[model samples]
Structure formats: structure tokens, C-alpha cells
Target: NLASQLTISKSQPIISGIDDIKNGKVPGNRIGLLVGSASLEYYLTAVSGGNPNYYPLYSRDQIYQNLLGNKIDVGFIDTGNAEYMTNDVYCNLTIAGSGFN
Candidate 1:
């Protein structure tokens, strides 16, 4: 399952929950979406509602790089990968919100 959620930089403020994203709470945040990914599909359908207010990167590696580089405030990524990236690889990043497929 491509269950996904948000991965945020440590320096960025934490969102309360996934509702904040669906309700457009983080309007000023830059969301990084992997192209052709389930997370992108979710954002397009549920979060963005067809609006494209995000940065489109092409790889899972790019997601981590962008978040670590501060190129994006948040990354919409698969839950497991996001967890590994946050907890194992990029210790300075954090997984925010909840998982959804």
C-alpha cells in the first residue's frame, strides 16, 4: 500500500493533523510532491483539489533531498519511506500528520 503522509523539516512548524492540509491550513508552506506518486494523486484529489500549489520532484530521493535542503517545507510521501527517511536517514526531518492511501 502506498499509504502516505507529510514529512516536514525540523525547523518548520508542525501541523495539527491531516485536516489542516485538507482544509488548506498550510497555505504558505511549500509542499513537495513526487511525480506520478500516490501522494501526488492524493494531493490532487484530496488536498489540492486539482490546484497545483506544490513543487514537483521526480524521485523518493528527491523528497528527502528537498526536505533536507529546505527547498520544500513539507513532503507528501509514502508512510514507511517517510518514517525511514525521518527517523533513520534524515534525522532533522519529521513525519507529520497521519497516513492515508
Candidate 2:
């Protein structure tokens, strides 16, 4: 319930890389978050770090593809899924630093 916890309480801030949310640099000044991603729903959104400005993606694969293609600035994938996506041969995506654990 960290997302809920953080969503309710906005004291602690969720820090992200500048590149992920810079004006006009990132699409819509928003990052893609998985609606079903527990970490993103709780952690990333808790402090309004990466709140949804657009629509949420159902599958991690979609997030991965959007991120790699620069359609979305960033996304929240499980650490495991991040690893898997990073290993994809077709991807040229780079992780935004220090957003998640």
C-alpha cells in the first residue's frame, strides 16, 4: 500500500531524473506507468513523482516498447521485468537514474 500511503501523504518526495520529466523533452511531460504495477501505483505515484497524465498501459511489454521507442519518457516495470526488458536485443532504452529501487 505504499502507493496509497504516499498518495494520501505527500510529505516525502519521489525523486526522478531530470531527463524523464523535462519540458518538451519528454512526451507530454509525463511518464508511462502501469496501472497494475504495484510499485508504480504506490511508490512512484505516492509523491506525485510519475503521475499519469495520459493513459496507463496494461502490459509491461507495452511500456517497455514505448520507452525504447521514445514514445514515453519512462515507465514502471518490476525490477525483474526491467531486467528482462533491458536485455531485449531490439531496445535502446536507458534507465532513468535513481527513480526506483
Candidate 3:
């Protein structure tokens, strides 16, 4: 239930860590996660402290696309997906802070 992790833009200033989300530095509505996904629910309850203001995405590709397009400020994708994005896919994006598990 805790295998999935998160990554965000290295350049994003508002959110450097999960604590930022919990502390309200990053607006809950600006966070992106897959719609109807268990990870979304887990993150909402475990990381966001039950704040339900995340933007629901349909797929990981959409999450990356939206992040690159600036439609979404930040997103939570699997750690491996984050690696692929930063290494083989979107070069502009990188792991935000130390990442969250």
C-alpha cells in the first residue's frame, strides 16, 4: 500500500516536500493525482491530512503533460515513473526535493 511514491518539478518553489502540502504552502487543489486511484486516497489521508482538494488526473501521461504545460502546478506519480520522466521523457522536470514515499 506504500510502494508508490511522488515527484515534482525541481524548479517549483512552493512545494519542496510533503510537509509543504500538509502545512498549506501548496494548495491542495493544485496537487494532481490519478482519479479514483488508491494512491490518491492514501495520499489524501496520509500525506495531506485528509485535505481533499487535489486535481484528479486520468493517467500518468496526463499528469506529466499537465505539469509540463503548467496546467497543474504539481503531481504525484510513482517513483519509477518519475525516474523515466526525468531521465528518458521530460527533461525539464526533476525529482522535487528528496521525493516522498
Please give each candidate's TM-score. 0.87, 0.56, 0.82
Clashing pairs in 2: 3-42
Candidate 1: tens digits of C-alpha lDDT, residues 1-101: 58887888878765755777777667624788988887887888887779887888999898889878878777888887888778888898887867877
Candidate rank order under lDDT: 1, 3, 2
> Residues 1-101, candidate 2, lDDT per residue (tens digit)?
22111010012123245333433344433457667667555534443556455437778667766655556655655655555555564335544444343
What is the overall TM-score of model 2 with all chains considered together?
0.56
| Every candidate's CA RMSD | 1.8, 9.0, 2.0
Where does candidate 2 stray beyond 4 Å?
1-29, 43-45, 49-54, 99-101
Task: Tell how far residue 26 is off in model 2, in angstroms.
Answer: 5.6
What lDDT is reached at residue 29 by model 1?
46
Report, for every candidate in turn, its global Cα lDDT versus the true structure.
Answer: 0.79, 0.48, 0.74
User: How many pairs collide in each candidate, listed in order?
Assistant: 0, 1, 0
For model 3, how big is the CA root-mean-square deviation?
A: 2.0
The window of 10 residues in a row where model 2 has the poorest summed lDDT is: 3-12
Q: For candidate 1, list the clashing residue pairs, or say none.
A: none
TM-score of 1: 0.87
Residue 4's C-alpha lDDT in candidate 3?
56
Top candidate on lDDT is 1
Task: Name the top TM-score candidate.
Answer: 1
